[model samples]
Target: MMSNSKEIYESITTKTIVAEINLSCNDEQIDSISLTSEDLQNTIRIEAESSNSTNESYCSNIIEESEYKPDVPTEFVPVVNSVFKSLNLAVKMYNDYAEMSDYKVKKFFELHNHPLESIEERPYTKKARKMSYFEKEFVVHASKAKMGPTMAHKIRAVLKGGYEYVRVKVTDYKNLRRGVNIILCYKDAQIMINKMNDRRDHYPNYSFEFLRDGDMLAVMFWADEREKAFYAEFREVISFDVTFRTNKYKMVFVLFTTVDHHKKSVTVGAGLLSRETTESYEWLINAFLSAHKGKAPKVILTDQDPTIKQAVESVLPNSRHRLCMWHIMRKLQANVTDDLLKNKDFKKRFNKLVWNMHIKPDEFEKKWELIINEFNLEDKRWFNDMFELHDKWIHAYFSDTRMSALMKTTSRSESMNSFFNTYSQFGNLLLHFMMNYDTSIQKQRNTQKELDHLTKKAIYKFISPRPIEKTCCKSLYKYIVL
Candidate 1:
């Protein structure tokens, strides 16, 4: 009976191995293969017997087991004759079945090979960096408020709790601002022109003129209603001067400034020109006159630029053009010898002669001639040229002109330029420049209004009991009550 059972078990095992190989061979074409209860019983019996077999017999059983293929493939396969089952065969079989069933296997990685960023540092990463609508609006408003990008970012960081919560770097803010400026630059000229037109339409006294060079803005001049009124009231002593490069295009900023009733620097009109040529200056002067109803100032003070002199001569021939005494005096050191400048006696006398408001032109000439003779500077070209143009700069020559004493220099214009520099930037687009200009002008007007209020409300005790003093205090501005 035992011999018969062994023969039966061996025969069953051999049959099971043969069936498994045959099933695997047909696995590519079959949908699936199922085993009967008898086959499962036979497999269990074979595994039990293999556990009790001798070492050599177990090794032989393992060899046979490795050679036997399963009906369905698995990820782990036994080696056959030192060669493992081909993964491509299993993959191809899976692919064919997947194609027939319209199915796909998608791979996903849940673990990363590299170290991950901490939560605090994640916001600064490129993937996490972004500007929201509110953040962008804040940045734009900050820019309009004259805040720089880094400052704006800092403010935003504070508002958002911290820099980590801001979700963007300072460079991102700068890049966004730069991009916005670039977009604005494309429409700057047209937008400025449109704004001017709109202002002109709304305010009848608001005036603006522009010259174009091949569709590009070359020159622009503008004066609001308040500025026009300022020009009308304080038009006697105008100081015109060009500021250093104040815009992106490297255009010259020509400001027409004057002293108001409060003796504060007032910008009556302003212009931007591509070039500082005579023609450009003439156009600007003409525009200024046109903006103010062609009411030329009685006396205009400016630095001694030949182009400006020619422009004034051609445009405002009736108006007296006086060179700025301050500018000429500033040039004294450069034009004169150190020996004469070092002479305290010569410096005192020269300054006294040049600044003497009460001196007659003949006396000024005689004193100047004596100084030149004493300094042995008769051969100095700058001195000779300045002497020849003495009538334009010397206080004695043009002092008789009405309101000429109000402005002996272009200092008002210089102050106005410095004031505007606070509001405007060299990299501003034309539209931004105009906006900053409007902001500055509005500030100036506000200050003027404040002064006007003070003049009207404030009372001063009479320092001297004189009718003229009382009358002047009541009539003139408080600042002019000297």
Candidate 2:
């Protein structure tokens, strides 16, 4: 009975204390104090208990699965195999952990430190070495000595020193030769200039000009006495066109050409211009005229380039300018449809409109409009532009000039380009290119001599055996048989 009475007294005292704490929390007088309430204290205690429970659970799991081993049957032989595997696995795990730790430490240090330069593996592997000055000099000497063999043969001859100092493959040798050519281009030009002056002294009629832009050869014009004599005879009509990428300097190769009496292309003068501009054309044309003693041709045919046209108009006002009909016709396929190009009737009609010298200008205009409208090509911009320039190229307008069938197109210049390509290639040193040009010219002159001999000896039979034809043939010079 006493113990029960004491328990009740203690329980009543505990309830009264909890009630007093609740009353203090709810009272407005204690709102300004910095003490935490019972709710907040309870939340803090719950969070602490959850955190400790999580740590205990994690520790238990880690210890329980710290090192797992596969089960083995007791009846199996070599029971020590399992033990050995576990020991090896433990060693591997230790090694992995050590490697990871080491990697992390190194990464941390790398992040804080300046980076080192990255070195390439096998830096010199499969790369071409730079050619020495002696090797390059030998290449030049060999080329001159052998009279310009292919790059492969040139390499073989150059590496005859047994591949010790010159350890270059064929391709590497070619690249090195190009570099050497570029290096010696200016010197080669100087040598060519000296040679030209020497020729001029020996043959007083030889004319040449040397033009330069800084260290590069800009424009070089040369006409030998034989070339000048040919120009004097065939100066009635001339054509010039620009060819490119035929020398080390990659200069423009401009050829002034004419047609011989036998309808053969003959080169009159040649130039290497660094640029293709109105100024360059102007200078080239002026040089050509000066070389021929200011005798401008009656008709000059060229590709329909606007810069060249403008230069011609400014420099050769007395000369009639005609765009190459062949050049203009080549663009038809690109500008017109395949169906139209395949139509034989359309091609025939187009050729008639372009080539028939009997067609009047008014008739040509009517025919051109009818053809365009019939072909539904009225909206084709290139065709329209070409139609606008018909007077410059059409045969009807060309009738008024004394072109004399000497040149209907710049095909003579194109032939000259094709002929030069047989001997010269792109990136030949400037001097070497000029020397090749001389050789080509000499060959052409030799052919001309052979043709002259043929004409003098061979009697051409007339296609129509008429009395007047025989008389005319008898009266004509052997060179004019064509």
Candidate 3:
């Protein structure tokens, strides 16, 4: 009975009307009545198969029964699918309506609101024209208010309820602050960023700071973690080298260190140099020390710059200053005559003499003495200086497998120097240096990521081909899927 009633009420196909009747007179209610001027005497009947209830109750019954679906399925799809599709449509329509409402509200405020100048309010678009005559006819007030049909204003006015309402709330921002973003647009930033990376100013957390101790200012930089946990896991390893700028007395200070693969891309400390001096280096070192107080490095790698060397040993007493082997080698090559340096046997023997990692210090010293005599470098200025640090160089520190490989040479440090030069040529100011900072680090990271990928690929290809292939696939999937 409920289903029947639902089906009946669901089928509403009439131009409905209701009339009051004399209920006790036994008069019948009409079901299908046709009114015509010619048939004025046509009698009406209730035509009910079962009708004991009141006339209104009977009509209500029919409406309630109309809720059910019909027995016959539509040609299109099942009722369940149709219901789902309808639900989806309803949600979409609701979202669209909400968006439209927001747009209208915003426009209404713009046209009718804001900017507190009291007078006769003039709408942005007063004289408006419509594309169709019906629209013009339907929208009589808008046409009167619009001065000219600026499409933008017209779109706003029409979508936004109207122009009068919109003119009410338009306003200028108060207490707004603005700052200069030199890499103004995305494309420009990209190019400059790329250029900085090429120069190895490093990327991600780039910083350019000028620390002044007296008159000299050092441009400091570090692309380390944002929280700057300058924990020198072992200790501080400072690698310093000087590269010239195109502008004279304008030195681009590129400072960095050697860390584990994971720690390679952090800027623990950095600064710029105007007049590279002891005081200037001292100030920069002090700033780094202040920030990373007890975490001073155990070793600092740098060339034989007297001022920088002195500053490091003085301030960071715990740090063991090691001269960059490359720099030492350069000095060795420079000091020795061309004939002596060109000795192929001497070059090979010297490298063997320096890299005595596995051997004891006494054994290394014994071999070093052999090379000294063979090359006649006993009295040579570079040979003695290079040999002067030999005791510290091949100590128990050099024999330690962990320290030896990482501290073997300043090649990685040189790579960092190359990085700084790649970035510094572009800008002289601090901000300019900072802007290129992250880009340099990102480049290093990207290179490392590539190397990692290649290494994984090679390893997988050789060890377990199928699993490696799957691993490679997973990486690729993640990249492209995102």
Question: By TM-score, how accurate is candidate 2?
Answer: 0.60
Top TM-score model = 1
What's the lDDT of the predicted structure labeled candidate 1? 0.74
After superposition, the stretches of candidate 2 with alpha carbons farther than 4 Å from their true spots are: 1-186, 400-406, 460-475, 478-482
Highest lDDT against the true fold, candidate:
1
Better of 2 and 3 by TM-score: 2
Tens-place lDDT per residue, model 2, 1-482, is 44433432343223211110122122222112111123222332333333444354533332244332324333321221122122333233333433443311111112222211112311222322455676566555555432343554446645575444345544565676676666776578787778888887898698888677897667778888777877877777788898876776778899999877666888889888888889888988898888999999988888989999999999999988888999999988998778889999999999888888678899999999999999899899998998888877787877766544557788778888988877777767777777678778878888987887787788778899779998877677643643
**TM accuracy, model 1:** 0.70
**Rank ordering of all candidates by TM-score, starting from the highest:** 1, 2, 3
Please provide, for model 1 over 21-94, each residue's C-alpha lDDT reduced to its tens digit, 9 standing for 90 to 100.
12223323332222222333344355445544434354345335533334434433322212213433434444
- What C-alpha lDDT do the candidate models reach, one value each? 0.74, 0.66, 0.48
Model 3: per-residue Cα lDDT over 355-414, one tens digit each: 545667777778888877876778877667657777545434544433544664566666
lDDT of 3: 0.48
The per-residue C-alpha lDDT of model 2 at residue 154 equals 48
RMSD (Å) of each candidate, 1 decimal? 18.4, 27.1, 24.7
Q: TM-scores for all candidates? A: 0.70, 0.60, 0.47
Q: In model 1, which runs have C-alpha deviations exceeding 4 angstroms?
A: 1-134, 158-168, 463-482
Candidate 1, 392: how far from true, in Å?
A: 0.6
